[model samples]
Target: MSDAVDPRRASAALLALGAIGLWGTLAAISTRVTAVPPFLLTGLALLMGSLVGFKAFRHKPPPAAALALGVYGLFGFHFFLFLALRLAPPVEANLVNYLWPLLIVVLAPVIVPGIAWSTRHGIAALVGFSGAALLIASSAGSLGQGAWLGYAFALASAVIWSTYSLATRRFSHFPTGYVAWFCALSGVLALACHAIFEPSYVPKAPEWPFIAALGFGPMGLAFFLWDRALKRGDPRALGNLAYLTPLLSTLLLVLFGGGALTPLSIVAMVLILGGAILGSRK
Candidate 1:
């Protein structure tokens, strides 16, 4: 085979794209899934992810990792995000959640000892928050009286996810093979929440499509592809490829969710993404 058709390179490229495609479509899916309670949806999607990830399961995680996963997987970003989806419009919710990457740039040093803060991260933080301000400001006029609750959860999703990202780095000895367990455990938590809160609601066939999409794609194969890409490919190129996620995600939301792009939203996207890239520079 020609060098251009190298098996490893081809597979990596395809997997990376698949992961990106799944993530990009999630907000659009959220629009169609409003009738589902966040936790109930989480339980089903994570159960599906768990089923696909069973091959990667090993023994249960160590105690500290398990504790962390309780927060990280069950009651943290994974949970908060789906809840945010229910609380806010998909576009606004997703934009706020995008702050996690910028937060991660700022937070990594705090979680990982010996890593020093840098001017680039400071710039990224400033720029990222400026964009965030515009996003909130732009949306403020028409926000429902109690919509802050949703926005708050949206911001919480970023903080929780950033913490989880940092925690994973801190607990480097934890086995990545335990992803299946994490999903399964998170599914259990979601199931409990569903039992308590959504007993009266019954799922129809339409809702299953969104839940299943999240399970098989973003929650399942995307993670597998991310691990494979990091191990087999050029890190810098993959990192650059990762940048496409936000823009594509936003594009997908606009295209499929029937969302509009106000001038402020457009500007906010540019600033947030620009700030993140600037800050992420080593």
Candidate 2:
């Protein structure tokens, strides 16, 4: 049993790593499509992501409650995130939004009955957040005094995502394929919001590639992998691993000409790695 369990745990970590790595590319890719409206971008990319569910389409659907929870997570998180980005300085909004991981580590016990929170878990989470804050703060400017609404929205995004992630474990009996419907339904809701609020504009030819990449990778396959990872792995450990996203994203941004890497980034990387390692301890 030990032999079998070890491999499963290893696979879960790898899967979580893969998902996080793909997410690392999100900032880099989004930079190229700045002209696209947020809602439309979300709608199109998520619609494309829904293709992953084609094979699962014929499977008996999960319960309505399950699908609703999925939509709440997928749509709700992005909805508030875009609002935060729109209303606040993008960097500040993003830093606030990244609180989801820490929330996960801290709130897991309350949300999931069998999970236990430890003092080490709290320390690991703060250490990881400190690393993320340092990394993100390196790019941010002075905080906007008047962007309270945006900050609130950013906080809401964090709460939505963290709760959604924890709630997913409650519904683990639902097939992973149901994620397709989740994506599809979420895409529809996004598009509907886009139609109702945002000015309509067609995506240009050059933008399709980036949109496809977003759909197929971070916003697409990443969700499926995340679901699998959470189902098989400890969410507390996975939460720490999530801190790597910002560090990796910053590096990718530097690679894509979005920014320059600094010595601080190296330090941030170390803190994040150390926290993840410490948090993963049994």
Candidate 3:
């Protein structure tokens, strides 16, 4: 085969990066709406994400199976994360959840046949994960104590997301627009969970813009971009690139929230960038 990169794959990588960049903004935007309960916030953001579906209404609806998969991925990932955060030390829980990217890198070959795994891929994933873990650990010193159940929930979130993304490849024919429906249905489910398990709190006017940013960026367009990326790009490369999210998120915090970066963060940046470059190689 020629050494030149496939145009479709290149485009897919860019889309994946776009998705990751949006996701990086989640923490920053979420800080602005801390008053909203988790489930309520999720519900509102996802509902806002459903706006993307409006344009796709005339297109053929996704199959029930695809919709189910989407729901399982979207709703399950967030639900499990909520449980993890509530049941354990938030920092620890989040760290455990970040395992999804590594899972994606390692599981790609098994989940999607003919996608070969290599030593470089494994090393890249490990290095990237280490960087992400360091960044997360440095953000807030961990209490180092969490319920085992909470850890399990965090692990489940990772598994759900990795499997969801890989399994999405099985339904590559589904339109990217289907994610809008996924957001709509998932939003309803999240709201119902909020109504049942949490207190109701209407978002204040000032919080609306942040909520909209959350919806339109991280929760909304990111999914579409991710779906397109997974369907078209090499999952291993995308997975390696995903390690940048937490680092980017931390940078956003420093830039916008007046937090200062430390030497450790600089080291983390080098590790993550190096890993990403290695994994992106042909």
Candidate 4:
């Protein structure tokens, strides 16, 4: 067991929770700001995140770690996520993307030698996916309506996010603020992509607040908190904690005018949260 008094663990718990909290609000926020092109939105959001996290870059990381950052940064993860959004409903795309948390749990011990591992994690992981399956089934009819490509993008987003999170472990020693640098690099990359593929579009005045909030909160502070937490806290616990994000996100959506919560979604939430707690237990 981890020491409760350990400052690092406490910090990690707080940071992780903070990230999850902000992330829960994302669906509601994004839905309201559909006026902006996804790619351009990605670039602008990341640019803001970069600015918010800019001070952390002073610590600086080595070259190989920097390479990993460029790949996994906003450019890689957000790009895929937004692309997924372009193709499908937020419910489906987000659920598929939730695969990252479970992947983090599964991959933790493999990447970090001293971390604990167990078969129960596999069982819990399946349960988590099963919850996601239930969600998909309930909403399954929403699929195959010309969103197959979107579905593919959503799954890919999951894979990319999972891989990116695990890969960051390799260079965890780098300052957490260095994430700003990654955000900046990703912003640049995203900007280039936007310039090439997306026509220029400006956000209406009403859209600015939502867009700015996304840049500074979820994309910015949440990422820094996640990096710091992962570097200091137990991955296993953090992974289990991540199970809450989807449930919370969905609830936020309903409350924020996105939609009503479904009976099936409640059932799915039970399975997901239950599986996460049970399977993640030592």
- For candidate 4, the 10 contiguous residues with the lowest summed lDDT are 137-146
RMSD (CA, angstroms), candidate 1 = 5.5
Q: Per-residue lDDT of 71-173 in model 4, one digit per residue for the tens?
A: 5755777777777877877667766777877777788788765877767776677677777667645644464443877778877777777666665666676
Tens-digit lDDT string for candidate 1 (97-208): 7676566656756776655667666666667666765654564446443366777888998888666655554655555555566677777888888888675577798888
Best by lDDT: 3
- Minimum summed lDDT over a 10-residue window in model 1 is located at 233-242
Question: Taking the candidates one at a time, how many backbone clashes does each contain?
Answer: 0, 0, 0, 0
TM-score of each model, paired residue for residue: 0.73, 0.95, 0.97, 0.86
Would you give me the overall lDDT of model 4?
0.74
The runs of at least 3 residues in candidate 1 whose Cα sits more than 4 Å from the true structure, single-residue gaps closed, are 1-21, 58-64, 80-99, 132-141, 144-156, 223-246
Candidate 1 clashing pairs, residues 3+ apart or interchain: none
Per-model RMSD to reference: 5.5, 1.7, 1.2, 2.9
Q: Name the 10 consecutive residues with the lowest summed lDDT in model 3.
A: 135-144
Write the residue-wise lDDT of candidate 3 on 1-282 in tens digits.
699879988998899999999999999899898889999999999989878667876777788998999899999999999999999999889989999989999999999977988889889999998888878777875467889999999999999999999988767878788889899889999999999989888889999999999999999989989999999988999999999899889899899974668888788888998889888887
Give stretches of model 2 more than 4 Å off: 1-5
Write down the lDDT that model 3 would get: 0.90
> Relative to the true structure, how large is the alpha-carbon lDDT of every model?
0.65, 0.88, 0.90, 0.74
